[model samples]
Target chain A: MNNTLATIDTPAALIERSRMQRNIARMQQRMNELGVRFRPHVKTSKCIAVAKAQRDGGAQGITVSTLKEAEQFFAEGFTDILYAVGMAPHRLQHAMDLRRRGCALGILTDGVESARAIVEFGRANGEVFDVLIEVDTDGHRSGIRPEEDALLEVAHVLHDGGMRLGGVMTHAGSSYELDTPEALRAMAEQERSGCVRAAQRLRDAGLSCPVVSVGSTPTALMAEALEGVTEVRAGVYVFFDLVMRNIGVCTEDDIALSVLTTVIGHQADKGWAIVDSGWMAMSRDRGTQKQKRDFGYGQVCSVDGTVLDGYVLSGANQEHGILSREGAPDTGIAARFPIGTRLRILPNHACATGAQFPEYQALSEDGSLETWGRFHGW
Target chain B: MNNTLATIDTPAALIERSRMQRNIARMQQRMNELGVRFRPHVKTSKCIAVAKAQRDGGAQGITVSTLKEAEQFFAEGFTDILYAVGMAPHRLQHAMDLRRRGCALGILTDGVESARAIVEFGRANGEVFDVLIEVDTDGHRSGIRPEEDALLEVAHVLHDGGMRLGGVMTHAGSSYELDTPEALRAMAEQERSGCVRAAQRLRDAGLSCPVVSVGSTPTALMAEALEGVTEVRAGVYVFFDLVMRNIGVCTEDDIALSVLTTVIGHQADKGWAIVDSGWMAMSRDRGTQKQKRDFGYGQVCSVDGTVLDGYVLSGANQEHGILSREGAPDTGIAARFPIGTRLRILPNHACATGAQFPEYQALSEDGSLETWGRFHGW
Candidate 1:
């Protein structure tokens, strides 16, 4: 059977190929202008086809959050991969295995203890592992501050232990919280300068620091310059979401990912059009809640991707989404969205939402559709 | 490789067998005392092993939120299955296909348009589907009100159009909001009376109404009696979560599902020990946010399931979780949860967290672990 939007099952992930290409080109162009290599984070899509599109758009290597993504992408013939999350001691063996299989995998570490473990594992395996010292640019989550003692300590541990101290990397993930260009540009500068400072510190300490990498979708786009950074990494930009829209990094028209759902029932008096796409399909990422504009669960759209302003998925159960207008109850909801009427919902966070579905229905501008499988677990 | 909790990969979904069995037994015993057949909702785990455990614990049938769950459970020999979500017209053929293959799959409907579509499809396809009219008991989401004329109209449409009217069902989903026992019991009665009243209305109109169903995790347990209800359906009770705990239905110790993770690094000044399990593992289910107690992502527990009071996953990224103290930053977090330290996080919602993983690591009492697969997408 033809897998058009109408024929496919409800609650299926839909990717507008045209918007995806545009998003991909936009990021690549920005990185190109900045004169830094683009290593698109595969953790967002985990789909080889999507990664291949990024590669075709000039992404040099791939960054992944888990070793499984490295393994999956490597097996599909994309070799240069970076395991971006801090290396766990228990997963060292898996990383080693992937590297030994000719997957040119790069791992990250922020703490002295974690760096020691990576060094010990690499030495024991007689493998010169490429390691990046995680630099804290925004203090959002993981990573050591550029000026922290642990930064030099981790670098010395990996370097002295016969491992490749590739460089320093940091993500200004805090950029997601900024909606203005001024704040985003400042965060971008902070991310780039922090990583470069860490790299310089290692170099000044008589350690070889080569590739300096930094980015987050907002910072990557808003950054005016990347004077010292050798490469930049970003995810969730290929399929801009409601969160990204609210962050002022991408326009709503740039969003490529949506869940194709069918109206199953309605609560007329309450003005709720019950749809099949619930938290189970759209995911539980309420990233837009704290942003300037809160798109409860998601922004509602027509079946063909026309924005239905003011209508959003106000609430969601396990398998049922309550689609309603934002201000007052549209008492004519039943008549507006009668049962069997198909619609699409743009998610709050593309990474979380895309992870919910096993495959995405990639719809081309010509109306042809293709099913692209995605990895589920670590 | 031995698959003990210690040996499994970090960021894995872990289910404690003993606690799950106890939870299953508790729910089953309550249904027995209340003289109602229990149909555990497989939407919680979506695992054949989990459903099998419920069946072994005397669960008579299964309730599913998606057709995929219905198909999977039926394929595993679960014959008395109920697709509890309101039936979409497009899915009628799939339902018929299951019934044609000897699966006693029951479908639900609440609106006249949906009922008419079901009748039309059933008549044209020469199938008599077991149809249940959904009654909205608590005004939480979908369903026709018990006293609404539409309930009778939907019943007649199904019965008079060559379909087997399977009575009525309702879920007091809003019961999840109440923490007090009085409020819970009242909500349970509201759900029960509302569904029973709908069945009575159908019977009073000279229609054969054999089944009357009502439940939600909170209501199912708090319900004092089920005077006219024949069956009960509850999902999250099979593996109670923090949301259930906050609702006063289960204690933190009763939570059987957790995300097994290992400390990969630390943000010392912030009193954060970063773990490999992020929102990808724990899910973005901030279900406890508005509750009396809000667990940022989840409550932190020791590797062996002991609750570490005041420690919670305060922040999460794609592949990183920040474990921190509730009131103050534990400045010695790096020492307390050093690298490679294994920990488990009790999720806010079991169903949402469980869906994040492709399979679960079921840990038994004797320090044994087994991998059980779960369905991902519909």
Candidate 2:
């Protein structure tokens, strides 16, 4: 593999380096202009190579979805790590180890049970960690009400237990449900306000909450104002996928990661082209299911890395994908490529699909291969 | 870690040794009575430890989804292996190497392109590989039509290129869609007839076709007659999941694997309990989406390893899942589960969830932990 030059590689993930750098820089510039810290989530690309790019591009810290990821990134010299998932007692020992290793660790918690568990674990282990109260801006997933008194009660318990109250964090997971930029912007405000209001409740209770984090790629990219948000944590923007395109977040040209597959067969009667990249390689993440048009799994691209018009992967099995054009122009894709011809498929969700493979064959601007490691499992 | 006894370690993936043994023996006896060879697909449980169980239960051969799995099982003294995935030119050399090590290797192909590629690779490497012509039974994924002349053409091409034609194989991927035993039996007939007809077409073309394989857990377990079928290659039956239950293939008690997760939080107002098991652990495979009752991701069970009547995971984020009542009696799950209480989740799709984790903390009949070994990955 060449350090600077490149060639296409098959049966591997091809990530565009320049596109990733641009995405990171774009997010950083926006956050910096708004006077907010950028703490991009590390779950999208569980690779140290991409995390370093974020750090180099001006990330003050990083958000992780798993404690395993926090440990891996910390070992690789990433000090300021946030375990974004709701922390449990079974994983407290691992969190304490990260703190002992001279790293600032922040954990997300919502209910009194978790808050009490954290307090009890901290008291028993003599470990003082940062706690972030996860506020549910939209009823998309887990979190407590930001404006409720429960926020202060949870904060008081953590503060009394010697654990520093970091602040409040909320993901506008509902932003992924938006159909327009205005909707995304509105959700972004809700996310910002939710975290800020939760932090304000902590302040009203005489607690010094420092950081207010808000995130979700769709909202983070479209938000016009950060307001009271101290930091932004978005992950999927580094590798925009088909889901982003369907939601109008990006275009086909903006997608940076794809699965390289080979044409295995053709059904002339049905005008179906079979490819080796199936749901296993592309992932069954139907993030685009809510969109107006559902591209079964992903958008089919040509061997030269160009998105083919009217051709979509209609369905996928475990090891095979069916490429078809429903009542569209018949270009005879079967004749264009004989068997063994390789093509790249832009994924529906980059994080989900990329997680399927162990490593990525990073492609330079000119299309050369450079292997980059991807961490897996919790 | 104890070699002599099963330990009560994690609550997730508690395997009942006796139940598994019975399931294996039943399938083996049924296939034997049908006069069809049992080549259990090993992708369901990539653990060599589980493969040993299959071998001990009289599995003559094993099917693998990846070359890495083939290599691993071959090293474990499993000589006969069928690489069930479509043969790509890039991976042909690896398959040839496995054959050179005195392993009986069979490759699957459905397209003329793959047929030609496999022939070219085999000719170049001077190796003879047994080939299975995959027939598309219900259009679930990949394969040629059983009645299409393309099947004969591909078989003729393989024979002309000096590759031995092993027989025909077809999977009724739609069998997973059936909700009745009658539907399953019908799918089994369709699967059997499809492969048998394809083999007949090859024989009519003056080609020697010895094997005719038909499979799918539902079809294999419910089919009354094997007729012209030479072998069965069903996977999922060993570790039934929520999807199987929804499809009426197996009951919740038949499921062997479950993700043990600790309750992290709860939304008392919404009546939701949050667990540490997310898509990262349980997988994003919503296999039950087409069923009448869509198990959001999995069925929730008590810590004692019993399925709760009405509890089902309603939604999942990257690292958190929400469990709520489906239709059964309310068990006050939200109030009962504290932050540290452990729960078990039966996966929607065993193959997908099993692939996410590195190893299983195998359990015994009495809910005690057994030995652990890492799974092979590409």
Candidate 3:
């Protein structure tokens, strides 16, 4: 079948090939100019096709959220990998298996308990694993307090064991809370300073701390300089979504992935056009909830992929989405949809929506499509 | 390998052979006593194992959300299936293919556009399709207005095109809005009235309406009688979730599935205990958003699988979930979680969350774990 036919024929994730290549190149150039290594997180586009583009665009290594992702990317021939999630005993065997399969795995840990578990697992299994001490930069999520002595204690615990300590890593998660590039830049400084101080503390205590990793799409993209950081791990940059747009990191045009849906029915009296795509297809991730503009779930686009004026997915049921053009004239476009008109919906969080499907139908700038597989589960 | 070890080791979905058997018997007995046929929706578990149980429970047919699901269930010896989503021109070919594969495929369409598309597709493919006229009850989602003459007009288009008019079906999606059993029964009446009225109109027009399907877990369970309804297509009753609990459909103890996550870290002073499971594993479906009590995502349970006192997932990052017990004493319980303590989290929406992961580790009431695989993608 022709690629265009393939794109429209099946229920698949359509990724514009040209847009993705451009997104990868742009991030790579920006990181290169900043003298930092690009460790593009593979969690966004779990497809191997997209990961190779990142590699070709000068990504030295990649970051993964799960061991399954690490193994999948490793099998596709990208080796230098950092399993960015905190290691657990249940996953230790899987981590060791990945390491044994020739993957240079770098696991993250924040507490003494996790450090002790990793030490015990590594010693018992005779697996010498590399570790990154996670530091809490903005106190938004997981990580050890950067100023606390616990950082040194965890480092000592890992060092005394056979594992290698790969410096400190932190995510400026709260940077997403910023509305301006200046705010993002400030959070970036906080992220870098937090990790740098943690690494320095460990080194001053006579511990080897080499790799200082810090990230978040906003912080990484707007940061003035890395300073002491060696690598940046940003995942969402690969496939920017509406949340990224709301944070001022990228515009709507920069979002490369979207959920392709069909306009199925309407309630013209209610000024509502119902689409076949619902939370099941588009995901219920309301990332824009905290943003200046909460596009309910996402922005609605025309069949030919134009952003519809004043159209938004006003509300969504399990398998149905209600579209409304609140401030615009109801030009009977709802009836015009005619049951089979294809529509593309920009997602709130690419990672969440993208994970719902098993693959992406790689679409060219010319609208031709091909299938590229995605990863799911653990 | 023993089924117990297989469940514990594989991250795929598992069905507690016994729990499923009991769930099937209970539903079947309830439906049989109510004098209604059970055409259980296959979209919930989407597993052959579960479908077989439905068949063994004497389900004459099944409802499916997508053609892909129809194909999977059909291949596994299910012949009677309803393609529950509104039919589009694009999917008509797949629907025809399923008919050719010897499955009795029923297509749902509520508009002239879909009616015309199905007619043309069926005419071109020389395949006769059984079609259900979808009726909009309570204006929750897709279906022609029951009070409008459009339902008859759409039915005429399908009948003129050589398609068999099976009957009418409507989902009481607004039944989810009801808080009490009386409210659910009221919505159930609305669902039944809409479909029965539409079917009567078709019959009055000299058209044979052989079936009437009404469904929604709340509506079906609380429904005093089917009355004019011939079959029901409820799925979530098999694996109740937090949303079901909020809707008063099932108690928390009836929830059979949960994500077994490990506590990985914590911010000691902030009272945030990080777990490995996040939206990636738990899904971004906040189905209980409208409920009186909003569990941010899901309810947190102890390692032994009991609901914890006041513990809930307050906030979540991509790979880490923050567990909090508002105003509860530090209890030193968080410390016990330490890095590798396993905890099970009940999902908000079983269908959406279950779809995120490729499989489920079925844990039995007796504490045995088994792996059960689930279908994914279109």
Candidate 4:
């Protein structure tokens, strides 16, 4: 910001605050129009400022991938939080501790095995935990299918075992692979229908399942209707990335997170200008590798946030990234990006890339920068 | 280590202390037998505890990839450090400051442009920087060719400009692609010959090139003799992962680092048991993707550290890993690795994986554990 890139250290995670705020406003407005409470996943930034901005933009609550996030956000005065990952039994005590501390934390379970553990832990601790049953709408990762008998069984375990069956949620994570609006809309419908179906099953079993939640960045932005869904959640939309660009969800301009790097050296003959933001800074997440158009580590941008059409980080090591043109080699790469010239690299996955940094240098529209701390690890 | 895995949180970075010490001993012993000083790269562990073990075992100094590492390690009393990446002109002031603060810091450069900058900065500051000429041994990443005229040009620029021509260094990073002992040994020789030749060029040009350094984890262990080499540098050997195992550098039993995770849920019909160690825990290195043996994200090991044949992390999301057998679906995955079962995941690239965590749970042979803090970011 304010051309201070020359002064800040190389390989710094930079948040283009203006773009980020715009992205937040867009999502919040969309969710508002859709008539559903928007719970933004804070796992993308893990920064209180970012989540605070979301909340400021009308995010009803926050979603987290780990209990660590729940604790950190809770400590930051965000009481309504969801530890979205399927609950591991060993983490029951930790989750219960947060609940006991009055964090209003919501724990998720996909099976009777973990639901039983949650019930047992609650019974032993004399606490009734608010539980969300994870339903799988897509064959991607975790959760029980909406039609599976385990859905009712897990719901009954939580309800009959004296725990508060709060809701059912599903993430169409496989929506990341889609490039068409039609497919995204269908997937959104499926996610909404499947999660709503699970909620119905619980209610039919005489259990109170109040919340029906479903979303992913693509589906959330493309869904024609929410129908029975009470809330929607999405993470990476906060700082769109190249992978999202490839999926036709967001443009490169929507990307807010970028790694500010300095040209360290060059391999002139190979048409390479080595930058200081390697995998350690940009992260090893090659989320764009198999996409329709692969942005080799990231898409290169001018220091002022304008996209550099051809240049990309074509290769990377522990601490060096080879920035080069995509088609033929830029033979005058050294002249093009001389040593000490600062540039920005838009990451493939904002969540993975942001996790690589301890703090972000948030660049505001007024050309001022703010240091925002982000928590790491569980 | 004692089976205290269950007590520790899932998705934790675990260092097998005994195995790490043994790895330190093995590398130190090889360096001693070769009559070369060993400077273990601190980039892999960044944990002063791990580097301390290497120092006590016979490593003379340490190799670091960034100035942040130099600062952190210097603060920890590791005054002798080599900043191995190509020196960026902007970082010269920081490097000089460290030198002024009594850090025997060594910086590197590959071409005339950066070499000129280093010389000018040193002269203007009246601080003679200890500069290493980075020689390209295998045409991998950075560094000038060992036989190129620019090698001597860089040396003369430092020497004539009133700076210390510290020496020459080369990392045989290409050895990571070799699996056989013969190929590894050959790579070691190539690395040695190229770096020694560069140092010879400097000495022949009447410049003081006191040190000749060479290595990588594979090359450092496989080199038959050091000859004119003064020191060897290697990282990741301290915590060998699947990439090293596939490179035939270290055995499964010798790997000292792993991710401690627990089964959180399962997609029984799909034979997928989801664990807490996802890309966020294990990293997205995929270093072994092109190697002879591709360990998806990581290799599966029992909580006690025994390698589980045919079991691998088939897919991973941000917070979930799909664990399944290789050739066939383990239909009874739920019964085999039920909910709450703790497991250890050996990562693909230890350097990349270890950086994912802020600290490591060091497990001692006596069943005791110590928390070793690791610094992250630049």
Clashes of each: 0, 8, 10, 0
Candidate 2 lDDT at B377 equals 36
* Tens-digit lDDT string for candidate 2 (B283-326): 77998888877778888877666887678888887778888887
lDDT (Cα, tens digit) per residue for candidate 2, span A170-201: 98888887879888888888888888888888
Candidate ranking under lDDT, highest first, comes to: 1, 4, 2, 3
* Residue A181 CA displacement from its true place in model 3, Å: 1.7
The global C-alpha lDDT for each of the candidates, from Candidate 1 onward, is 0.92, 0.82, 0.81, 0.91
- Native interface contact recovery, model 3: 0.78
Please state the CAPRI-style docking class of candidate 3.
Answer: medium
Q: Give lDDT tens digits, candidate 1, residues B1-378.
A: 788888888888999999999999999999999999999999999999999999999999999988888898888899999999999999999999999898999999999999999999888988899999999999889899989999888888888898999889999999988999999999999999999989889999999989998999999999999999999999999899999999999999999999999999888888989998899999999999999999999999999999999999999998899899998789998899899999999999999999999999999899899999999898
For candidate 4, list the clashing residue pairs, or say none. none
Candidate 1 off by > 4 Å: none
Q: Distance from true position, residue B16, model 3, in Å?
A: 4.7
Model 3 score (lDDT): 0.81
lDDT of 1 by residue, A166-268 (tens): 9999998888888999998888899988999999999999999888999889999999999999999998999999999998988889999999999999998
**Candidate 4 local lDDT, A234-346, one digit each (tens):** 99999999999998989999999999999988889989999999999999989899989889999999999999998999988989998999988899999988888899999
Better of 1 and 3 by TM-score: 1
lDDT of 3 by residue, B176-291 (tens): 87889888888888788888998899999999899999898888888887788899988887887899899997876777767777777777777778887778767887777779
- DockQ of predictions, in order shown: 0.91, 0.54, 0.66, 0.86
How many clashes in candidate 1?
A: 0
TM-score of 3: 0.96
Q: For candidate 4, what TM-score does chain B get against the true chain B?
A: 0.98
Per-residue C-alpha lDDT of model 4 across residues B214-297, encoded as one tens digit per residue? 989999999998899998899989989888999898888898999999999998888899999899998989998999998899
